[model samples]
Target: MIPANFTYHKASSVQDAIALSQKLGEEAKYMSGGHSLLPMMKLRFATPEHIIDISKIDGLSYIKEEGEILRIGALTTQSEMEYNTLLRRDYPIFMDAIKLTADPSVRNAGTIGGNIAHGDAANDQPALMLAMRATIIAEGTEGQKVIPIDDFFHGFYMTALEPSDVLVEIQLPKKKKGSGGAYHKVERKVGDYATAGVAVHVVLDDSGICQEIGIGLTNVSAAPMRLDRGEAVLKGKKITDDLIAQVGTIASEDSEPTSDLRGSEAYKRSILNTITQRMIRLAIERAQH
Candidate 1:
């Protein structure tokens, strides 16, 4: 399917993109990588009258640590993050999720910004970002604003970003010592969206108690959700068989999954429970080392 007729404008800067979006109003769509928006447009699920191309804008694709936080440019591709030496060593959680996203072709072109900006629950990055406790930086005509990852996602295909705002960077706080994280998913096939996906970030204290933990769920809700109730169950406690079971129960109880081609509601919730436990255990094991 081909997209409907549209005017195209290549933005040379973030400000230019904002200007274009503002001038074009709600009928405009800012495009980067074009993996998410283009497909929807082709299907007529989205029919923007104007395409503001921000892919050509300079300095929007890079990875670097700023102070205690890792700042990722919004245009950084999944493939780039998967292979980034800094991230691969210090934040394997990202690599775990990025490698599982679609296939190589898609990963090569898909931008991290696009993934989160689409606000699709099935997208892998949002869940991982939540687990990492990341933040988003949005630049618009009014200037820049920072939004916590938890508050960034609003609903299905919805986010805090205004139509005229462009997401410029993703900020992730550096994990402390004894920190370990993992991502797991049950998908129908390679490159397919998950039936259920889970990400866990854990930090253990010297006494082997869980000092901090973040559990993120995907495809189990209308938006990528952080399992705060489940995390509360593990925080400050030692990982035990009973405690693990309790966390899994909390995760399953809190998720709001719907029956679809992926699986039945009961089946998805069941998988969520199983994977939640597995990811937590894996994270704890890694943190022990």
Candidate 2:
């Protein structure tokens, strides 16, 4: 099916994009990579009157570490992240997820910002962002606002982004000593959405006590889920096999997956439980290195 008729506007800059969005109001949609918006438009699920193309906007496609933060520009593609030396050395969890996201061609054009801004739990990056405790930067006519990852997703296909706001960057704490993260998902086939996915980030002290932990679940709820209960059980304590098992159980119980083509709710819960333990163990091992 073809998308509904829409006027196209190419944004020369971020400010231009915001201005166009504000002028068009709710009738305009910003197009970055177009991977997310285009599909919806084709399905007639979204029929905006105007498309403000921001894909050509410069200065929104880099990955770098500045001071205590690792900053990724909004327009950076999944392929860019997959091959980045900085990401590979410091944040393998990204690699874990990116390699599983769609195929190489899709990854080449899919932007990280679009993935999160789409507010789809099936998309891979949101859960990774949640586990990293990342920050989202958005720019509007008023200026920029920093949004915490936990506060970003409100419900299905919804986010904290205002109609006139353009997501500009994502920020994560720089990889520190003794910190590591990993992502794992159970999918039916290559490039498929997860039946259940888990992303785990951990900071372990020299003596093996867990200093910090974050657990984020994907495709198991209306919104991406952060396992605060599971994190609480492991944080500030020496991580044990028993505690890891307990966290897994907590994840299975806390996730809210529904029955669908992916699998039954009970089946997804079981996968979540097993992967939660596996990812936590992998994160710990990496942290100990």
Candidate 3:
């Protein structure tokens, strides 16, 4: 299927982009990497009257350190993020998720903000960002606002972004020395959506009691959900194999999955259980010296 006929507009600045969106109203769709929007457009899942291309916007495509936070511009490609020395050193979890996304060609083109802003439950970063407790920054006709990644994902193919808004940057806090995170996903094939994915961040005190546990799950529900209830049970608890296994058990109780070509509701739930425990342990191992 081909997308319906649409007009195209390119904006070279954030203000210009926002203004164009307002001019185009709800009939306009913003284009970043075009990986997400184009496929949907081809399927006619989305048909907008105007395509406002923001790729030309300057200063919206770099990874830079801002005090304790890493401010990732919305247009920074996945490949850039994957190979970034700062990201790899400070937050390898982001790098882990970046490597699992799409494939070489896709990574060369897909942008971090596009992945997060699309709010696709199957995408890597939504869940990873949730687990990292990152902050998402959005700008619009109204003003700029910072939203926690947990709240940014409203549901599948949905986000907290207002129609007039563009996600400009992601601000991730500095990782403490004893903290670490990584993502693991089960994909049926290369470039396929995840069957089940888990992102875990573990923080250990000097004495090694688990100071914090952040967990995020994908494709087991309508959204990439942070496993807050489950993580709560592990935080401050001694990291035990049994306790982590119990977490895998509790994860199943919270999910709402559907049977499809990918797998049965039962299968997704089971995989979700298996991977959550495994990734948490991996995160723990990485956190240690």
Candidate 3 displacement at residue 267 in angstroms: 0.8
Model 3, CA-based lDDT: 0.86
lDDT tens per residue, model 3, 1-289:
7788999999888888899999879999888999999999999998889998887788888988768787889999999988888888878788777777889898888999988888888888888888878899999998898998867888778899988788999987677778989898888887688888999998899888988778988787888888877898899988898998889988877877788888998998998899988898889988895
Candidate 2 lDDT tens digits, 152-211 = 999998899999999999999899989999998899999998889999999888888899
Query: For candidate 1, what is the TM-score?
Result: 0.97
Backbone clash count, each prediction separately: 0, 0, 0
* Candidate 1 local lDDT, residue 131: 84
Tell me the tens digit of each residue's lDDT in model 1 across 1-289: 8899999999999988998888889999999999989999999999999999998999999999878888999999998988899988888788789878998889999999999999999998888888878899999888998999888999988999999999999998776678899999999988889999999999889988988888889888998899989888888898899999998988889999999998999999999999999998888877777
The model with the greatest lDDT is: 2
- Worst 10-residue lDDT window for candidate 2 reads 203-212
Superposition error at 289 for model 3 (Å): 2.5
Candidate achieving the largest TM-score: 2
What are the RMSD figures for all models against the true structure? 1.1, 0.8, 1.2
Worst 10 residues of 3 by lDDT: 90-99
